[model samples]
Target: MKQGIQAFISYTYTKNDVWLITMKDMMQWVKNPIENSHLTKGYWICQFNDKIKCSEQTSNSTTKKVTFAAIINVDQIWIWQTAFLVVLYIVIYRYDKYMQEKKKK
Candidate 1:
């Protein structure tokens, strides 16, 4: 609740394209859109293989839906959390104000 612990993940995905991507250093937890400094933590479980040399659909991308599990980790980076919260509140406050003004118009 007072820290952020984002995981490190990377992978390549392609639908009908012929190029491979190497996603690297993907931070797990992300700040809420309305908040800048407030850090959050989340987990995602899916199929990944570093040895996917061949460019094949990792999981039937053409299908209507895919099955994957999500798990949130309880680990928190205390220092970051505090910083995130401070910034988040400021942003949220401003965003709320903006929304109220838009409604009045």
Candidate 2:
């Protein structure tokens, strides 16, 4: 059971001590220049980090931090795609039911 569970939620930190539930945290960590330079080695992650690093100065204000967080949220493509799939499923299910009812009438 432990192995099975780990297979699904296996994303880990540098130390392997901390377990993260979302990719957003990983994305944020990858963007940090000092904290985890090793992670930026990946081509895609590096590109994403470069794109999201909107501000030049390292010391960002509260508003800038919030904006950065929002940008990260938006950049999480899988989350948006999953949400769209769920909505599409619901619409298709409802439409199927409506069609069945119309056929009965």
Candidate 3:
């Protein structure tokens, strides 16, 4: 038997955990990022502060901080092709700064 490329992938994320499950096998958790998957479509989890960890960010009743976030939603998602991302972020950064300066006038 042989395996084939996955057509669709769905993901769910919490503070400490990221789950990438395929349509084929709903039970299995695919950890590796695959090319041409839905992840490329949009929204990803970007976990900053390697030390603090998303788990630690989880909030309780009293203090509520961001627990898990989608790249476009809460945080940014990690993608395989990062070179382009760097450029994209830089452009966004510069654009934001530009907008702020324009408003300051």
Candidate 4:
């Protein structure tokens, strides 16, 4: 029987929003100790609110094993966009109120 390596990556878009990635039985050669070492291992782009993509290769030697894990922190752009929408709603409500008052006069 042979032992396998497991790795995981977890990150938050905001204080509440979180995303996770996990790889089981991964090769040991691609292991990284950093929290968000996306560029260190290979050429890959990670986008916020997008599905994660992964690639790995194992060594020819069967004795040694390796694994890699990374967690990326994305900006809370969704939270900001929600706030802006709320402000716009308030402005529209106020405008409607002003128009109603003018028509009564």
Tell me the number of clashing residue pairs for each predicted model: 4, 0, 5, 5
Residue 32 Cα positional deviation in candidate 3, in Å, after optimal superposition: 38
Lowest-scoring 10 consecutive residues by lDDT in candidate 3? Answer: 50-59
lDDT of 1 at 2: 35
For residues 1-105, what per-residue lDDT tens digits would candidate 2 score against the true structure?
Answer: 111111011223335443322334344443443353322221111112312321112232321111111122444545544543443344335445555665699
For model 4, name the residue pairs that clash.
27-66, 28-65, 28-66, 28-67, 29-66
Which candidate model has the greater TM-score, 2 or 3?
A: 2
* Model 1 C-alpha lDDT per residue in residues 14-99, reported as the tens digit of each score: 35323211111112112232242222112222332321111112245542221221122344334444443443355445546655
* Steric clash count of candidate 3: 5
Scored by CA lDDT, what does every candidate get?
0.31, 0.31, 0.32, 0.34
Better by TM-score, candidate 2 or 1: 2
Q: Candidate 4: lDDT over CA atoms? A: 0.34
Please estimate how well model 3 matches the true structure, expressed as its whole-model Cα lDDT: 0.32
Residue 50 lDDT (model 1): 20
Looking at model 2, residue 86 earns an lDDT score of: 49
Which candidate tops lDDT?
4
Candidates in order, TM-scores: namely: 0.29, 0.30, 0.25, 0.29
Highest TM-score against the true fold, candidate? 2
The residue-level lDDT of candidate 1 at 30 comes to: 26
